[model samples]
Target: MDYKDLRKEYLKHRLDPASLHADPMIQFKLWFDEALQAKVDEPNAMVCASVSAEGKPSSRYVLLKELKEDQFIFFTNYHSRKGIELFETKFCSLVFYWRELERQIRIEGIAEKCSAAYSDEYFNSRPHGSKLSSIVSPQSSKIESKEYLESELKRISGMDASEIKRPEHWGGIGIRANYIEFWQGRQDRFHDRVCYTKTESGAWEISLLAP
Candidate 1:
């Protein structure tokens, strides 16, 4: 099979700089709403990339829990590899690709932990099984076997729901974006790219890039 032969043209939509919102957050919401209307699966899923202190980079897909006026939020274990890296570097990138819509968004930002109150609120709202899993799972850590995890999960599940409070090791991390780029695929590979960069004076500078 020829791998290079498995390409398809992307002509579903076009992005215009003039049509973008002055506020990147608002623009993101507009596109996010369109994605929802288009029935894009897991539209809030994004690839989060972080680098360790020694410059080793790692990336994984995570759900975008909440989008705030100043930042994008996602939750995870504080001791996880990505969490540790994010806290150490305080810099990360997020990528969202919606194949069904032939669009993508890239964001570079600073990482910060969300407030404990917010974390607790979100945790309490989660499903019971998810809550148990969060309490028992030592994410990114090696364990003896699957049985160990199952046992731990079972143990946690047996406890009273009210007793299962949010662990201090698990919570939300917010990314304050300094740069964001929106990409819309087009015919003949001449895609459209619009970039928003935050300036030192707290203003956004928009620009177009050649595709």
Candidate 2:
């Protein structure tokens, strides 16, 4: 199969800077609500890009667990590669795509560890199986075999949910955005992008970018 020519034209909607909310987070919530209304599959799924101290980059998909104040939140094992990378460089970029809506959201920000209390609260609310898996697996670590992981899972399966506590190495991280860009695909690939930058006085400066 030939690979170089693959492409799709975006014929969805136009994004206008003047119509966006003054607060980027509020604007984000509004777009997110539309994604939900459009019934986009896994709408909360987002790609998080992190850079190592050596300038190498890694990207992966993580579900957006929560959005609070001016931040976007997600959870994972603190020992994971992304976690360690963020520990070294306290920042990351997030990309959220709602294909059905032909829209995308990009965020750049500082990632901070959320309060232990908040992590515990969300951890407790997770489904029982997810709670068990978090306890059984050492995320991003090499394992001898799949059997070993299954055995560990089996070993912990009998434990009551109340007895299983959120592991010390697992928790939530929140990203307080410094910049956000919203992209809406338009006819003939003439997409519209509106970027919001945080001003020194705590205001947002919105701009339209040539697409």
Candidate 3:
């Protein structure tokens, strides 16, 4: 197979500044809803990027747990790479791509820990195995082998679900976006791009960008 010969031409949609919502969060929810309606797989999954105090960058996929008050929420172990990095830098970015819709959304902003009550509410709503995995698996930690994780899960198996508390090291964080960009695929690679940035006065300014 000739790798260079493979290509995809985007013709799914077009995005214009005039058609966007004044609030980027509202726009995001609209797109997100469309994605869900279109039956996109894991539509809430997004790429989370963070930088460490040493300026090292990290990226991974995390599921969006909630969106409210212009904030996007996700959960993870407080000791995970992303959590530690956010703790040190107080900033992060997330990218959502719905290939079926030929669209992508990028967000950048400050990240802060959610209230413990909110975290607890969300954690309690998770499936039993997900809660157990968080309790047993040391996310982002170097372990000897996969067997160690399996053994740890086994160790927690006998415990009652109600008795298993949300680990102190695991919880939720919310990204309060300062900048948001929406991209839509166009024919011949002239993709459409629009960016919205928050101003000091709490208003958003929208701009069109070159593809």
Candidate 4:
């Protein structure tokens, strides 16, 4: 199979400089709304990239659980590979791509742990099975077999909702973005790129980049 042939032209939309929002967060919300209207699958799913203490980089998709005034939030096991790296470096990048809309958003940010209270609130709101799994699964650790997980799940399945509490190792990470770039696909790969960088005075400076 020739992989070079697996390509398609982007002719869906074009982004205008004047149409961009002064605030990157606002711009993100606007695109997010459009993504929802376009019926993009899991529009809130983002690729979270983190670097280890040794400068090794890794990425994985995580659901965007919340978007705050200055942060993007997601939850995971604190002991997970990404989580450990985040704790160590506190530096990360998030990417959101909506193929259906021919658009992508890139964010560079600092990662911080959310309050324990907030984590508890979100955890309690999750489905029963999810809550159970979070407790049983030692994320990013080696496990013996699928049967072990099945057995663990079975043991905890009978616990009532009140009995299930968010474990100490499971919580939310909020990323405070300092730079954001928005990309819109155009004809012949001449894409539109608009970016926002935070200034020293906390103002956002917007710029257009060549495609």
In candidate 2 the C-alpha lDDT for residue 164 amounts to: 88
Q: What's the lDDT for all of these models?
A: 0.94, 0.92, 0.92, 0.95
Model 2 regions more than 4 Å off:
none
User: On residues 118-152, what C-alpha lDDT tens digit does candidate 3 reach at each position?
Assistant: 99999999999999999998889998899988988
Question: 42-65 in candidate 4: lDDT tens per residue?
Answer: 999999999999999999999999
Model 3: residue 29 alpha-carbon error in angstroms: 0.8
Collision pairs in model 1: none
Question: Which stretch of 10 consecutive residues in model 1 shows the poorest summed lDDT?
Answer: 152-161
Measured on C-alpha atoms, candidate 4 has an lDDT of 0.95
Against the true structure, whose lDDT is highest? Answer: 4
TM-score for each predicted model, relative to the true structure? 0.98, 0.96, 0.96, 0.98
Q: Which segments of candidate 3 are over 4 A away from where they belong?
A: none
List ranges where model 4 is wrong by over 4 Å.
none
Worst 10 residues of 4 by lDDT: 143-152
- Report the C-alpha lDDT of model 1 over 1-211, residue by residue, as the tens digit: 9999999999899997888999989999999999999999999999999999999999999999999876999999999999999999998999999998999999999999999999999999999999988888889999889898898887777899899999999999999999999999999999999999999998999999999
Cα misplacement distance, residue 59 of candidate 2 (Å): 0.5
Q: 53, model 3: CA deviation in Å?
A: 1.1
Give the CA lDDT, 0 to 100, for residue 180 in model 3: 97
Comparison by lDDT, 2 against 3, better one: 3
